[model samples]
Target: MATEKRNYKRVMLKLSGESLANDKGFGIDPEVVYRLAGEIKEACETGIEVAVVVGGGNIWRGLKGSQGGMDRASADYMGMLATVINSVALQDALEKLGVSTRVQTAIEMRQIAEPYIRRKAIRHLEKGRVVIFGAGTGNPYFTTDTTAALRSAEIEADVMLMAKKQTDGVYDADPKFHPEAKMFTHLTYNDVLQKQLAVMDNTAITLCMNNSIPIVVFNIDVPGNIVKACKGETLGTLIEGE
Candidate 1:
C-alpha cells in the first residue's frame, strides 16, 4: 500500500516547558514525556524530518526571576540550563521509544551533548534523527519561542508547530478566562502582530514572517495531535504571510 503524502517534509515542534510537567504542575512528568515521544515516533515514521525546541518555564522562568530581584542576565542563563535539563529528559524518553534522537545545546556542555552545529543538525534530521535544541540561543532575554523560530529558519523546516497544553488554538483573548474569545483558524503574520496575539512573542513571529515560515498553534493534550499537525491536517490555527 502506498503511504499517504504529508503536507510538510520537515517540521519544527515548539513545546512549552509546562507540557512536560505532571498534572499541569511543575517538574518533568515521565508518563507525559513517554506519550509525547510515542507521538513523535509516529510522525517520524511518516518519513518527515522532525526537530523540537523546548521551553524552560516548568523549571525556571527568567522573567519571574528578574521580577523577584535577581540579575536579569543571570536569571536568564539559569533558565537556559533548565531547558537543557528538559531536553535531556526528552532525549531519554524518545530513545526508550526506539526513536533516534539528539540533544544539541547552544551553550556547549560537551560532556552531556553535542554543540549546536547547523550542518550537523540538518544531517541528523536527514538521517531520521530528531534534533532537540536547548539553551535558548545561548543568549539572555531571548525566549525559547524565538529559539524555535530561529532554528526552524536555519533548518529550513516547512512549518513551525506550536504545541500548547490545553488551549485549542490562537484566540482573540485568553480562552480560559474569556468565554467569548474567538479562535482564529487562519491568520497572516500581520494579523498576529497587529492583533498582538499571544501565540508567540513578536520577535519569534517576526522572524518567521521574515523567513517565510508558517506556524501552527494547537492543543497538544489531545493524543495524535502532533502527528496530525505534521501531516498538515489543520488541527489548529495556521499563521502565515501573504
Candidate 2:
C-alpha cells in the first residue's frame, strides 16, 4: 500500500472533443487518438495511474441546441451521449495501439462498458489500467470539467491535467483573438474563479478548490505533453496548490 510510489501515482486527464477531431468537427480522427494513446501508454509504462474525462464539443454541445428550444436538461443529456461516442472512439484507438483501457460511462451501457462505480474505477487504476470516464457526471447542466473534479476527488488523483486544443497555458485573454493576452505560467484556484478566468465552469472550479486538487492546463496538440506533465514537467500553468 505504498501509495503506488509514483512521481504521480494517480492522475485525472481532461481532453476536449475537438482535440480528437481533425479540422472538421464530424468524427473522431484515428491519428489524433492514436497519438494520445501513445502519450498515455508511456505514462502507464512509468507506473502512473491514469483516468480520463473527455468532452464532446466536436460531436455536440448542449449549449448550441437549435432555437427550436430544447429543454436545458434534455440538451445536456444529448451532450452526455456525445461524450460516450468520443469515449468509444478513444477506447478503440487505444486498443488498436495495444494499450489496455476501460470506458466507464455514467449513463450505464453494460453491453458497451461498465457503469461508473467509484470503487471499481479506483481498483482499475490501482492495477495500472487507464480508466476513461465518459457521459459527464450522469447529471445535466454540468460540463466534463465538473466531472474531472468530482472524479479526481473520488479517486484521490494527484493532479488534474486539462488538455486544450490550443493555447498552452492560462491567459488573461483568448490568445487567438487578443494578440497580447498575458499568459500565466502559474496561478491559484482563486484566480481562476474570482477573476472568472474561464479555465472551466464555475461549479467545476469551485469543486477543485474545495477538494484542494492541483490542476495543470496545457495544450494537447503537443504529442508527449501528457506524460511530461504527469512527471511534473513545466509545460503549462499549475493552479491551486503549493
Candidate 3:
C-alpha cells in the first residue's frame, strides 16, 4: 500500500550528524545512512520536494572545544567540513539506492559539490532530485540548525523537519538523563526561545521565528518517521506561531 501523499511542495529536512552514526558518535553508519536515504526516496516519489541540512556534532562541536585554543573561525570551518562529510555520506547512500541527489556546499569545494545556488537548488527539487545542503551557512559561530532555517527561507520551503537520534519530541528537560522530563506536543516559537530548549540554537530560533517556518522535532531512529513528518502526521512537537 502506498502512503498518502504530503501537501508539501517543498520541505527542508534537518539531520544531525549523530543520525549518520550510532552511540559511537563518530563516522557515518552505512545502514543508518541507507535507511535515511530510503525514506527520502519514498518522500520524493510521493511528489514532494526535499532539501536536507545535516549537522556536524558527530565530527566536532565548536562550543565543546572552544577552550582547546582553537580559533573560532577554524573550529567553525571544521564543523562545516563535518557537515560536508555527513552530506557526502548521505549523497552516496541515496545514489546507491537509486535516488538522484546533489550535494551543495555553502563554502565552495568545486571538486566535491556545487556551491550553494538558490535557483539551481530549486530547479533540482522541481525536477525531483534530493538536495543535501552542507557547510553550515558558510560562516562561523552558526549552528547547522540555523543553516537549515536560512536555507529553508532561501528555498521557500513549507516546513523544517528536525530529526533527532532519541527522544521523539521536544521535552522540558534532558529525557535521556532525566526520565521525569515532560514533553510538549505543541509549542510556540517564543516558548522554545524563552525556555531555552536545546532542540535548536537561539540564532536558529530567531531565524525561524522571524520567517514563520514551522519546525517538527521527532526521533529519526524510528523507521518511517521522516515520511511521517513529511506526510504531516501529528507525531512530533510542532513549533510555530503561538
Which candidate number has the best TM-score? 1
Worst 10 residues of 3 by lDDT: 1-10
Q: Global CA lDDT of candidate 1, please?
A: 0.93
Q: Which stretches of candidate 1 lie over 4 Å from their true place?
A: 1-6
- Candidate 3 colliding pairs: none
* Candidate 2: C-alpha RMSD after superposition: 3.6
Q: Residue 115's C-alpha lDDT in candidate 1?
A: 99
* TM-score, model 3 to reference: 0.95
> What is the per-residue lDDT of model 1 for residues 152-201, given as tens digits with 9 covering 90 to 100?
99999999999998799999999789999998888999999988888889
Predictions: Cα RMSD each: 3.2, 3.6, 3.1
Candidate order by decreasing lDDT: 1, 3, 2
Better of 1 and 2 by TM-score: 1
lDDT of 2: 0.86
Error of 1 at 156 (Å): 0.4
lDDT of 1 at 183: 87
On a 0 to 100 scale, what is the lDDT of residue 68 in model 1?
100
Q: Which stretches of candidate 2 lie over 4 Å from their true place?
A: 1-6, 66-68
